[model samples]
Target: MVAPGLRRYPVTMRLLILIALLNLPIDVAAAEDRRVFFGTWGTAKQCAREPIKPGGTFLAEPYEIGDEWLRQGQLWCLLSWGPIEKRPDGYFSGAHARCGEDTVRQYFLGMVLSDGELTLRWGFPASSGPLRQCPRS
Candidate 1:
């Protein structure tokens, strides 16, 4: 004979489970901007006050502030990375990050994917670590 108490126990558990599932999601949208730690393996710091510390993860704003490089006289050599939204045609549009009164935007060519790190690059990509996901709350 089945135990009388066991029958009620299963029903009670099911009722509690249903209530929790009905609550559903309560969080920020997926498109919301979030600050996260930007990870990189190799770095070039000839101009930065302190060279970007490698190995250990460093905190950065949600936006991507490309490396600042000024050419002697009148040349520009800058490198930056941002979220890439790939389209059906394989083309992508980068969300332009604004700073002060200027705009931070770049055209991405390709990304170097490895076991660790993702290097976002345009044209011929240089050797750099890949951009990993580190969403900070």
Candidate 2:
């Protein structure tokens, strides 16, 4: 009841399944490693002063790990869905799209230093200071 050329189909499928299973852990580990921005980030200084106050605190949650981006939210508002890239100087830079604003789609850049300081700049005013990482609940 089996074709001559199709006899190896089951074995081939099994081998493919096994290979995919073996790669699962590596994929998961990579995702875990990309979760560097997950958690609450806070700063006493204002990060924006143009359209609205950037607030004293912001949280970065895992959104699309495959895209290497986080869902950045401020107090009671979603700020940006942006990508955070690591620099060679141990600093992380992120360009985020400000949410709930004009159709102009202004992009803001934020840099987090090794000492937990964050520098954010957009259009007019900019903010920079030490940012404290909030304890996760």
Candidate 3:
């Protein structure tokens, strides 16, 4: 039985429509937001101040990534980091190189934001929790 004013789509057309709907992408902006790992991240006390001290002894871990480099200390050239790459597992990995000292080769696993808290997963299963982004001065 067909409605008076409604026309039925062919089975092939209906299948195409279903396929198109299934292949349609979710929110692209939201997906991109999840992948953002820029800016400085630290603990409560660390991020409490407007400008985080560059070389604070109290901070056990300092994580900062800029446009081209990842820094551990306040000084830019002190610690070296290679180009970071996003892995297939949705984690960023980079080589922490300390050139000209002992030629040490360290690595940064990745970082992710969950519920506004940024977590840095780097080395030996150690992850920083409840780290917030510091306000840029």
Candidate 4:
């Protein structure tokens, strides 16, 4: 028979290792959660220079605003080059968002795409706000 002290040792170690292995992807993604936001045309210029999924966009509508943040605000639509990194949790991160001139009035934007939806957060020296995406087509 195995010694009492050693009986569960190997099994416990194996289980711990297994757990860590299972969590490996999440650990790596957590490390990549790091991100940055840009404002004005500056961030857009930089993102536009980088490689991404060409013709990306951020579209928002007034009535679609969730009840929690409800208002008859202006509808906004922004465009970008493409998809950024998609995390293990299915959240998408990307750089370089340019707002629609007439609708959004031209600002730098950052986006999180998931949940069959897109959420945009704009940044500027003076202000920022969360805007939901209304997909095209």
Candidate 5:
């Protein structure tokens, strides 16, 4: 009792809908796994009292802990105290402390620019510098 064209339309729409539903989770998972700041960064400018130097580099590794994407890395020659939280403005802020022969603690703030350059600052002794992204090997 149904028209020949109408029967194919319903089946076609259902197939399209099913395909979209199947891909939704995969698309979401891919987005969550991809991180914008996951790489090594280096600078040619030196900051007083900072560990990274004109030729030195640091690594940024992004991981999901709970419901947040945290970027963890070493700065000023010490491991970060905790994961740095990314802000709405694309900047990350956290605290780090180093212990050994000389103990040091600092609050860290950094941002990745549109050109892929990184700018960082460490409180106390006041160090700030610009870093460029390094090529992956």
Candidate 6:
């Protein structure tokens, strides 16, 4: 009992449709969205130097933002971020949990990306100036 004017495809056509679906491209857009902020950002000197260790010198280390994780040399804070939300003030914000040594801290992150520079503001009265993307070694 077929419905009005609707025709069923043969087995060959069904197989072709399955093959076409399998040949579709991978979810590249999802990958791109996850890596939108994936890069190492810092001053030229920081980018050139090797990553500093925990409890090491207090130099302003660069930030390495990767898929779902971020790392900074100073204090060895490794941050795990939730979804980033776009704000009305031309910035993106997120809530992140940072783990360093024996301490864990939570903060709201506000970031602005322009050109190849990334500016970040978190914590009270603290901010990161314009940091440029590091060159690949």
Clashing pairs in 3: none
Between candidates 2 and 5, name the one with more favorable lDDT: 2
lDDT of 3 by residue, 8-122 (tens): 4576688899887865553343334333666787775665542446675455445675544556555342333333444454434343433233454555545555555666666
- Give the per-residue lDDT digits (tens) of candidate 1, residues 1-137: 88999889989999999877764432122122211222222322312213235553442222233333212112233533344343343323232222221544443334444454445444454433444443332
Give the best candidate by lDDT. 6
Give one digit per residue, the lDDT tens place, for model 5 in 1-137: 99999989989999999999998987575445334544555553221223444455543332111222223343233334334444555544343434233665434434333355555454534543355655444
In the range 65-107, model 6's lDDT, one tens digit per residue, is 8765678865444455544444444335454646566667766
TM-score of structure candidate 1: 0.24
Off by over 4 Å in 2: 1-34, 44-89, 101-105, 123-125
Q: Which regions of candidate 4 are displaced past 4 Å?
A: 1-78, 95-104, 114-117, 124-137
Model 6 CA deviation exceeding 4 Å by range: 1-31, 50-60, 74-91
State every prediction's TM-score relative to the real structure: 0.24, 0.39, 0.45, 0.28, 0.35, 0.57
lDDT of 5 at 50: 35
Q: By lDDT, is 4 or 5 better?
A: 5
lDDT to native, each model: 0.37, 0.48, 0.54, 0.42, 0.45, 0.65
Summed backbone clashes in each candidate are 4, 0, 0, 3, 0, 0
lDDT of 3 at 9: 53
Q: Of models 5 and 6, which has the larger TM-score? A: 6
Worst 10 residues of 4 by lDDT: 34-43
TM-score of 5: 0.35
TM-score quality measure for candidate 2: 0.39
**Candidate 1: C-alpha lDDT:** 0.37
lDDT of 2 at 116: 53
- In candidate 2 the C-alpha lDDT for residue 79 amounts to 44
